[model samples]
Structure formats: C-alpha cells, structure tokens
Target chain A: MKIKLVFVSLVSFVAIAFLIYQWWPSPERAIKNRLGGLAKTLSVPANDGDLGRVTRVAELRHYFAQDVRVRAGASGPEITSRDALLGLIGAWTPPPGGWTIEFVDVQVTLGQQATSARVYLTAKVSGHDARTSEPTLDAREANFSMAKQDGDWVVTSVEAAETLQRPGSQD
Target chain B: MKRLLFGSNARLSLLRAAVLVVTAVVVFGYVLLPVRLQGISMLPTYRDGMLNFANRAALWWREPARGDVVAIRMAGPRVLYVKRIVGLPRERVEIAMGVVIVDSVPLIEPTVVYKAPWNLPAFTLGDDEYLVIGDNRVMAMENHDFGRATRDRIVGKMLF
Candidate 1:
C-alpha cells in the first residue's frame, strides 16, 4: 500500500507540473531578465550628447524584432524588416530628445506562449525654444505584442499614441 | 477544538492536482493565442481585436498565396509581423508617388487607396524573399518594399 501511494503521488505531481507549464510560463522570468538588460542597452540620456544615443538606438534596430510596423500618426504605416530598422534610422522621427519607457506592464497566456505588454514612453522632442514657453514635452503610450516562435520571442505589433495629463500635452 | 477535517495525505494530493491544471492551461494558451494574433491582421475582413489560429507548420507542406495574410519573424530572437502577399518571387512591382505598377502594367488592386509608381527600382525577390504590402499603401516601409521577405520569417497563414 505504501508503494502504491508513492506511485500515485509521483504521477499526480508530474501531471500538475505539466499543467503549470501550459497555463503560465515560470520560465518567462528569463525573458523578463533579458528585457531589463535590453532596456539598459537601448537607453541614452537626452542631452546635447543625445545624438550619439539616438545613433546607437538606430544601430540597435537591426537586432530588434524584424516584424515591426510603425503606424506614423495615421498617415502611412511602415512594415520594417531588418534593413529598414537599421539603415533608415535617420529617416525616422522618433519622439524628440529621445524617448524612454517610463513604465511597462505584461500579461502572459501560457498555452499560446505569448505575452502582451503595454509600455508607456516619455519622449522629449524639440519644439520652438526656451523663450517660447520652453517647448512642449511629448509622451506616448504604446501597446506591444510578443510571441514565442521556434524557441525565440519577437515583437509582433505596436499601437502608440501620445498620452497627456494637461491641455495640449498630447502631440 | 477544530476538527481535523482533512488528513495530511488527502490534502497534499489535492493541492498538487490544482497546481498541475493551472500550468497546463497557461502553456497551451500562450502558444496558440499570440500565434493567431500575428496572422490575423487582415482588418475589416478579420477585424483587429479578434483571435485567429496559426498553423505554424504550414510552410513545410505548401506555399503562400497572392492574398494570404501571413505572420513573419524578424532577425531578432522572436519578433513577428503580419502582412498580405502582394507579389511573387521575381515579379516587378513599383509604387511611384502613390501608384502601383507591375512590369509597366497597373495592378488596380481593390484594397489600395493610392497606387505607387513602378519606376522606384527593380529588385526581383530571391528564392527566400516573399514580397508583401499592407491593404493600404502610402504607409509602405523605407526599403524598396518590393523586395524579398525571407522564407524562414514566414510564420503561418491566418484562419478565422
């Protein structure tokens, strides 16, 4: 009877473990760690030296997920693969003074091996001048979707809009 | 005194079962759900927020069609994007100003709002690339978008 009890317990344990893997990714902690590391790499101070950071971020684009679509303020959308992200960084007008992720939220569905994240951005773009009310501050909120494929995770889509707390803050 | 309603043996077994069930649901849902979202970007036709199914295993069996919406991966670890197939391998496509011309002939695609000029540049798709475009142009990418999309990036076609 003792042997039977142990066998039953072992079988039940294995089954439960499998269920957790299907339901939620405890392994995704690795992905979280990588994300924090990547953020540090992409981050650059927005100062007179901001140009270098912008350039580095542009170069980093090549390493970014290829299936990026930038919906340019309701004008046209760009389906950026590696070349567009890496080579055409100069053409892109990312929010001025360079932007950074102020906050990030993630929700994971284990069965699909997918994660949905909402990242809030704080961008400081160039406006008129200090004499003219110190130029406007720009901020954007973007929603991103990432999925696992063949043992890797890549960004799939992003929807971004400027979020403002006051009058005319959103640009 | 509180009754010993649950024996240690029975309670332990029950707790184990609950954890197992939760894990399974998470794994299965994650893979299936987002993979579906990737290929279902055919808006208006497929809508934006609905969930679609992706049989990531399709590329091994057959090739994509002219209008098949597909999810593709980028060079990075796991980036995926979706778009509709516009041209085939080695076909000439031009979107000048806002007009689309293929080999000196206008495509007159039903979905496009503005056509691109055909004289932008001529680059035939390599065996690995699959030329694509969104339902609405004018927002085309920087590259002479008439280029190739690597075969490996092709995730899967969309399903309602």
Candidate 2:
C-alpha cells in the first residue's frame, strides 16, 4: 500500500512539472507577443491627436532593427534602412475613418540557434475609403525575419508573399 | 434513470465518456475542419459569411481532379482561400479575354456566370503545382487572386 501511494505521488509531481514547463514563456511566445504589440501600435484611431500620431510613429521605430529591409508588395519600393521606413511611415496619412491592422494565422519558426525566427502571417487592414466612405478590407500574407536584440525580438526584414502572379511575370 | 443516463457500472460509464470525447476530437479536429468564408471571391457559388467544412480525408485515395473546390492554406490553417482547380499538374494554363485555356484548349466552365476581358499569357504548371481560381470571373484579373499553388499547400476539398 505504501509503495502504491509513493508511485501515485511521483506521477502527480511529474505531471505538474510537465504542465508548468509547457506553460512557461518561450521564445516563440515572446515573438508572438511582440508582433501583437506591433499590430496594436500600427492601428490608427480617427480621433487621434497630432501628438499621439507623432508619438506612435516614433514608437514604431523600436519594433525594427537599425538596418531593417522592408518590401511592401511584389512591385512596391523597398526600404533598406529603418530610418527610411520610419520616414515613410511618418509621412503617410491615414484615411478619413482611420484603419485597424491585425496579424492573423501567425506561425513562427525558430532558427537552429533559437536567437532568430521566421514568421509567416496574414496582415489584415480594415478601413473606410476616403471618397465613398465604403468599408474596405485588404489582407495579404507576409514573411518577417526577426532576431533577438537586447533581450527583445526585433524585425530584421519583411517581404510580402503574393498569392497571385501578375501577367507576363515569370516567377 | 441513472443507469440509463450513464452505464450499468461506473467503470463502463467512464470508459464510454472517454470514448465519446476522443471520437469528437478526432472527427471535428482532424476530419472536418470548419472554415468561414470571408471575401466575395467566390461570390456566385459560395457567398460571403458562409460556414463550410473542408474534408481533410478527401484526397486520401486519389489526387485532386479538375473542378474540385479546395481550401488553400496560407501560412497556417487558420485562414484559407477557397478556389477551384482549373489547371492540372504539368499542364499549360492561360487566360485570354477571361477564358481559361488549358493546353491550348478553352476549358468549359459552367459555374462562371459573368466573364471579363482578363488576359494572361500561357504558363506551364510545375509537376507538383496546381492552378486555382475563383468562379467570380466578373472581377478584374488584377483584383482577383488566382495562381499556382503547391500540392502541400492545399489543405483539403470542401465538403459543401
């Protein structure tokens, strides 16, 4: 009877330890949390003040590395440095109704060293057209390369993965 | 009444409940993956905001044939695109004035109600690639999403 009780206690302890290990914060989870914060920061509110807009744009620079590469779309211009990206973001004006950005179906694959990760996700932007006030939703798949920098994940590169190929384009 | 609700014995009742839970998990999580339609890409055949299931076991026996509507997974299974297979593997596909040409032959599509003057040069699909497109050809080619998808990216065929 005593042996059976000890075995049961051992099994319970092991199960609890396993559960805790599974629930502990991991690198993948950290990257996902950072991406979520980025999406939240990218969303623009219609009633935002000029100061808030400037502050948010400045905050966006922290999400990327100093030499981040950004390719907006298949044929869009590429920004080679974080400063260039910040310049574009600061100059862009939101629509009349503002817009909300979300990242869905995020799948993060850690590199062999675990210091870097590759994330594939769908970037969804929902807003209203300035001309017609009609609601518009644009979703596209994007790939992000990130690395651990100063104890936080920072995006190093971004590339849009187009689902459809354009005419006369060989890819 | 209690015996009828559960089983004759406690052990049997526990076993029955466990079996039921396992079956539910297997059937729903693996066999029939629930999908919610979002866009107007499949306007005529499947409207927006429709709930459907993609049978993951549909292609277990044979490869996907032409006209089979499938769910193409992007990045992950959480969001997928519903499109019909038009060009088979290793076949040349083109869209000239919105008419799909497969291997220089114009393929007949009874589902497309409206046709636009969409043009795309002929391109051959790879061995493991399948070309998919929506039934709503009325939309501009530039606006629509249609192209070659690898075999592994296809999640499953739609089960109505």
Candidate 3:
C-alpha cells in the first residue's frame, strides 16, 4: 500500500507540473498578444473623412512612444516624432473605392532585458486612389522595436525591412 | 550472473524507447528542421509550397559564405525567410541595370533565374552585416524585398 501511494503521488505531481507549464503566461505570448491587437487596429479601414481618419490615426499614436522614429519604406526618409509620423498619415487622401489592409505572419521576440520586443510582420494594402481612381496594391515587410512603458508596450522605432511582390503577379 | 534491473524484455524495450526519443530531439531540435516555403521569390530553387530542411548544424562552427542559401530568423521562427547571401561584411553593393556590382566589380551570380532593371545606389555594408537576395531577380526592383540581414538575423543554411 505504501509503494502504491508513492506511485500515485508521483504520477499526480508530473501531471500537475505539465499542466502548469502548458498554461503559464510567457513573455513571448504577452508580446504576441499586444502586437496582434495593434495589427488589427492598424488594419482598420481609414476610408472615413480626414477628421474621422485622423481620429483613427490618433488611436494609432497611443500605441507608440512620444518620440517614435518611423521609416515607411526602404528608400523613405526616417521621420522622428509622434506628430511627424501622424502628419505623414494625415497627408494621405483616403481611397475612393475604399482600402483593405492586412497584417500577417506577425512574429514577436522579447528582448533579453525583458523590457523590449522586436516584431516582424507583413502588411498588404490594396485600394483605389481618391484622385485618379487608379487601383493600388502595396505589400511590405517591416520590423518594429517596442518598449514596455508602465506595463504597456509601445512602439519605439519602425524600419521598412523589405518590399514583397504580390504572390502570383508576374514580374 | 547478469540480471536486468527490469525484466530482460522490458529493459530492452525501455532502452529502445529512450534512444528513439534522444535521436528525435537531437535531429529535430538542432540538426534538421522542416519548413514550408511561402513565396515564389526563390523560383526554380524552391517552390512556393515545397518542403525543405533547415540545416542548423551548418553554421554551428563557421559563418555562411556568399551564394549559400540561408534561412533568416525574423521576429521569430514562424516568420523566417529563405534567401541567398550575396554581399559579405564591408563590401559595397549596388545594382545597376540588372547586375550586382560589388566594390566596383561585377558579382557573378549564376543562380539568378531572371534579371530586371534594378538600380540601387552603392551602400557599404557594416561589420557582421550581409546582403541577401532572392534567386528570382526577374521580379521588379520595387516588388522584390531584398536587403541587409545582420549576423544574428541569419538562422541557418537551407538544404533543398
């Protein structure tokens, strides 16, 4: 009876330990969850008027630090400052046919210090221009550096990593 | 007399199970990892839906050489990309008309399946930095995403 009790106890302990490891909240999961929400917020259609769009853009600014440095494309100049980044977005005219944006393949890695994270993701934007009504399709790969500020993750910097060709499109 | 801790049959079975588990962990964890290709940027070398093995053991002792196909570690393992390393550290790379110019010399890339007019100004690479590009260069300069990948970004060599 004593040996049987020890055996049962060992099995129960192993099972409980496994359950804890599986359900524990990890740093990678935390970063991924934050970035996932950010992606959804960024992909929201900005077809509303400049004022409405600006409000949406303002929602984006809250995800970033006050002094955020952003480079939109590989050849684009780096804009430093939250206002400047928003200004660049505000300058854009909404598409006449509406726009569809998607962020996919999001991968996040926590920094060694545990206070920073690096994210790599792909963004696809397709729509028609408001002025000329020309169809526009843009796909890009970007890397974002995020920092933890007061228990909230905020974007510190963004770099345009690569420009991907739309799949199945002939070069 | 020799006696097994467990019965002879059970001991042999447990030994076989342990060996199998160890082999699987070593092979899948560090030696060879399977990945699915997502895009046609690699073209004739790797198809869009083909399965390939990432040879992590390739870079264990040595750095990757130019023209070697490699997988890069992006934000995480799930978003890694496969590309060929072209420019090594300290080398200036420029694309003129469809050819790659390295330090004023034309770089010989035999695996390039297509060549499109890609004009990029010369940029010197920093230490521990590498220029990675796809084999399908026929894609327009604007469409293809080729850029610098630092040492830590590279995950391992790709085996087709």
Looking at model 3, the pairs that clash are: none
Off by over 4 Å in 2: A1-22, A46-49, A96-99, A126-137, B1-20
For every model in order, the fraction of real contacts preserved is: 0.00, 0.45, 0.11
TM-score of chain B of 1: 0.59
Answer with 2 or 3, whichever has the higher DockQ.
Answer: 2
Q: lDDT values of the candidates?
A: 0.50, 0.86, 0.76
In candidate 2, position A65 carries an lDDT of: 98
The sequence of per-residue lDDT tens digits that candidate 2 reaches over residues A9-95 is 986999999998877899988998899999999999886677868998889988999999999887789999999988888888777
Ten residues in sequence with the least summed lDDT for candidate 1 chain A: A162-171
**Over all chains combined, what TM-score does candidate 2 have?**
0.84
TM-score, chain A only, candidate 3, equals 0.68
What is the iRMSD of the candidate numbered 1?
15.8
DockQ comparisons of all candidates to the true complex? 0.02, 0.51, 0.10
Model 1 spans > 4 angstroms off:
A1-35, A38-171, B1-50, B75-78, B96-99, B102-105, B113-119, B140-147
The runs of at least 3 residues in candidate 3 whose Cα sits more than 4 Å from the true structure, single-residue gaps closed, are A1-14, A25-171, B1-11
The clash numbers for all candidates, in the given order, read 51, 0, 0
lDDT-wise, the better of 1 and 3 is: 3
| Model 3 interface RMSD, one decimal | 9.2
